[model samples]
Target: MSERKRFYLTTAIDYPNSRPHIGTAFEKIGADVQARYRRMEGYDVFFLMGNDENTVKVARRATELGLATKAYCDEMAQQFQDVWRALDISYDYFIQTSDPRHHEGCRKFMQLVYDRGYIYAGTYRGWYCEGCESFKTETEIKEAGGVCPVHRTPPVERSEPCYYFALSRFQPALLDYYERHPDFIQPEPRRNEVISLVQSGLQDVNITRIGQDWGIRVPFDERFTIYVWFDALLNYITGIGYGWDEERFREWWPADIHFIGKDITRFHCALWPAMLLAAGLPLPRRVFAHGWVYIKNEQTGAVEKISKSLGNVVEPMEIITKFSSEAFRYYFMRECPFPGDGEFSWSRFAEVYNADLANNLGNLYSRVITLILRHFEGHLAGSRAWEPGEIYEEQDLEATVQQVQGYIENCEYQLALQRIWQYILDPANRYADRKEPWKLVKQDLEAAARVLFDLVESLRVTAILLKPFLPRTAERIYRSFNFSRDWQQVRCEDCYVYPRPVDDLRCLVRPGPDGKLAPLFPRIEIR
Candidate 1:
């Protein structure tokens, strides 16, 4: 047997300022899809997600709640975990910046750069955005009236003694790296943005703050604490056992991909590479900066960021509970363009959920099995008995699989799903309508059986393709048709196998008299 390929992936650790909303859930869900896809392709996938707990926002939130910083972080960590669990995120490890191992890893990284003369003592006097946890240059602050543009609030001006990393030394190297590896940052637009920023010039970055007591303390200088970004960025490596387990760290070092939001691309693509270069570490292969999620407010009829402060945050759990997790996952994956901003509206969500999941896919599955019982006494003929014919020949299963795979490789998740639905599911539904399998049965049983078999084959292929995107639903469909429930054994080629009635699956209904039916996605009625 050949060796199983290894894949390492991570999402930007979230700052636990509040409970997760739909916006934050988007990143976790997107990363989860990628991890699932890699696993389906038989890779040894390690997906790391985490909470950035060293932020001043967490400290402030804790103070407001009259809780200790650690206590607050612990609570917030659980909240984040709850959201990820509810969303069915399959991350291998979830690291917290406040973890002792993470602190050790960050200190070790700092020491490595310091030993190389890439870090030095310095004083920083600048305008800081507490919300962003980064200093904003005058040019950035100007458009927002001396405030942080995203938060729409004035920054706190501070002067402090700090330790600085020699980021200025890596401008030429970073530009060259970007040129040599054009795909280092994804979505072309993000790469262009990073290139422009680097061409402007780079400056040394402050690595530690003197007055923060709630963050990781510097290894050498105990008086200062590590900056949030400096400490938080290391969690990606720390989660994989960077400080304590060299063997494990080396196994997955040089992550295959880093999935982050667009707002922070500069930090991940620019400063992160410089830090790794200083420490003589290999850089992550790719950084994909996905766009933000906007919610269309019903009252104002205007789109806005999904934020608690704006009183417009949509609770992810509420949606997950209202609709099945499959519907939740499908809507986001289908509606949102992976590389661009996506709008979320209850009306739109309901429409897409009903149209795609309930009406299209669910109806297709129900109709196929229903027709099978109506025509063939609840029995499906094996592939050997069913000769190939026209209704199925036009689907082109191989080309559809190749097209979806190519789109996935390019990180075009929306496009990948769109193509699958268009080429496979939609075509199956249309074939059912065009063939009128119910009508065919009265005139000719064999011809009708062939049509039902064609539809069943299409569904099997779709289930295999849908495994990574909608795992639970895929398993349900597979088992409903008497296929093995062992998902790991589910391969694209299996779709070609014709299945007959199995004793264990007899409890599932057929389409004729006394035949019961279950809707994959039940239609929702809006109040």
Candidate 2:
């Protein structure tokens, strides 16, 4: 077998201005799935996430909340950690930009760029928003609107002496990087956007903000601190010990993927690679920008963006409490393609939960287990000496298995799941139609055992493939069959081990009238 490649993945470090919503949660979950899948494939994986804590937005929010900036950021950061935990997000490192180690790494990176002649000093005159902490051009700002588009607050016009990075110096190099590495920014639309922006022109970007005492001090000048993007973007490198530990840094630099929201694509796709090139560091392999979720009125077809001010923001915790984290994860991925907009509605959520989880998967599991319990005294039948199956069944099952592997490898999880369910439905229909068990109870007990064994083996395969998405549900199914629940313990090609019959085996989920029904997903009435 060939050696497995190492994988490094990251989510955009969230700005800790407020608690995260479902938008941020989706990105984290997507990265988590990718990391978990890589690990399952025997690849070394590093998944990094953290808060972007150094910004005028954070500082002002801290003051408004009547606490020191550090304390305020610390408090908000905890909310992110709590949300990640509730969602069962398995990250290798949860890095906070406020950590002293990160501070040291950021400083070292800045020093490297400065030594390369990419750094200069200049005075910036533009529409500055204390809320955004960035200079915005007049054309970029809305003419009729007083507030910033992002922060939705008024801008503060100011001029200050600051350290600047000669971004124009890397224009040719950045364009070349894009030409050579077309996959660096994902989805043709977003990549074309970046290309057009780069070709239009580049400008010298201010790297430091004067009077921002809350941020890291510039190496030579106490009056200036690193700009928000320059400081925040470094979290990806610093979190992995970019400058502090040479050996550790070498292990996971140049992330395989950086999953970010569409709004911040420019910072990650355009500026980040340019900085890495200037410093002779590796550029990220790919940057995927996902679309925003919008809330729409069912009757009027009116759509509005989800946000705090609009009172439409869907909190991560609220969704987790209402539905299992697995359900939330599955719904988001299945509802839309990875790179496109997806609409969210209470009705749509209910429909997916009831149809996919409760009715299809959960209901099928209950029926199979219940039949095993009722017919064979609640214990799986003994393994019978086997014979080869009909060519059609064997071929169909092999095809489905191969499809499962393909979808997962390509990161098309929804398709993977659809394929797994196909295995379940096909077997369930075959078992019901055979009626071989009824005839075997008297004269053909061995034939009955063979039929039942095939069903149980199908369940085992389903459980193994479904673990990454619905871990808890998969575990329950494994326990119902009295089989080992650990994915590492079972090989995909291994024949299912028939558990010795136990008199007290019970169904994990009760079934309904169509079979034996249980409420895997109880109806949730949203307020």
Candidate 3:
């Protein structure tokens, strides 16, 4: 047998100036789903997540909190990891920019780029937005009426001596690279925006700023700190052992995917690749610029960007505390298109949770288990063993499974979930409604057992499909039955094809005192 392919994946490192909000959580969740899916597909996956601690804004926030910079960064990194763990993010490693390993790797990278002759001493005069921790182009400022549109504050005009990255020198190479690898920047709209920007022109960017104690310093120029973006983007390499571990670095250098927010597409697509080119390193396979999660204004019913100025920053913990992490995961992956923007509101969340989880999935699980336990003692006859096809005979099972696999491969998570519901869950729920297996138990006990078997088969198919999106919920469903395939060993192929007939299918779940499996998702009241 051949070896499994290594899949190195990462999400954009977030600033630890504040705790993570839902908008921040969205990108992580999207990346997590992909990582989980890849693992299920037999890839040796390395999922990396982290905090961007080296920033002016972070230092300022630390001072206001009356804590040392390192202490503040450490505390917030824990808080960030807490939410990720609570949501069941299966990241292989979490790297902090403030860590010694990262600092070492970052310095080595700076020196490599410098020695490659891409660095030059220069002076810059531009509009600098401290909130963004970067200089803004005049067009960007003018378009926003001289204010940073995101921060809603005027950018200060600043002039300082700094070191430059010869980004403009890489324009031809960048354009050629984009043309050769059209799939490098994902989601057609984002790819178009990046191509247009490269066609316009490339500008040499300032890679260093004078004397900041909180950030990584330029290796050759000790008097200056590396610019935050220049430092921040290096986390992708530093986390993977760019300088420290040669073997590990070579193994995972060209990331399978760099999942980032759409706001920073330009940097990842243009500047990041150029930096890699200068250092003679391979470019990441793909940079997927996933969209933002907006807030549905309850009063106005308009979806607006979740921002501090709007006073609508909803924390991930709030949702997790109120509902199960499974509910939080399902809602976002089902409602929000991963490649495009999605809106969130308490009302919408409740509606989806009730309709999808409680009514359809939860109700089906409870009804099927209760039927078997009540009339037949939770076991089908030991003599009964049948092929999976004999159970799910009505549907073109393989075709539907292939469709979902395709949707998932393309990162069309919302559509993938929708298709599973429409073709699989919805049909099962409707079958339950029409068959009324509870009522059939009275008429033909033998015939009713057949219906129960069919419904349970539906649950099996669903558990496999939902594994990546809702890991906990899927396992709960799969482990409830004594199936031929092990819960951990199952994959997309197992949905339609099986090794042998299901032998003496019996429920493995223990019931409560009342002799009933508990509801997976108890309905939530929005108020």
Candidate maximizing TM-score: 3
Model 2 lDDT per residue over 412-449, tens place? 66677777766655555456457555566566655665
Using Cα atoms with residue i matched to residue i, what is each candidate's TM-score against the true structure? 0.94, 0.87, 0.97
TM-score of 3: 0.97
355-428 per-residue lDDT for model 1 (tens digits): 98999999988877777655565676544233334444534666668778777767788998998888888778
Displacement of the residue 215 alpha carbon in candidate 3, Å: 1.0
How much is the lDDT of residue 353 in candidate 1? 89
Give candidates' CA RMSD values in order. 2.8, 4.3, 1.6
Model 1 alpha-carbon drift over 4 Å, by segment = 374-377, 382-389, 392-395, 484-486, 493-515
Q: What is the number of backbone collisions in each predicted candidate, taken in the order shown?
A: 0, 7, 0
The window of 10 residues in a row where model 2 has the poorest summed lDDT is: 383-392
**How much is the lDDT of residue 245 in candidate 1?**
79
How high is the lDDT of residue 290 in model 3?
92
lDDT score for residue 366 of model 1: 83
Please say which candidate is ahead in lDDT: 1 or 2. 1
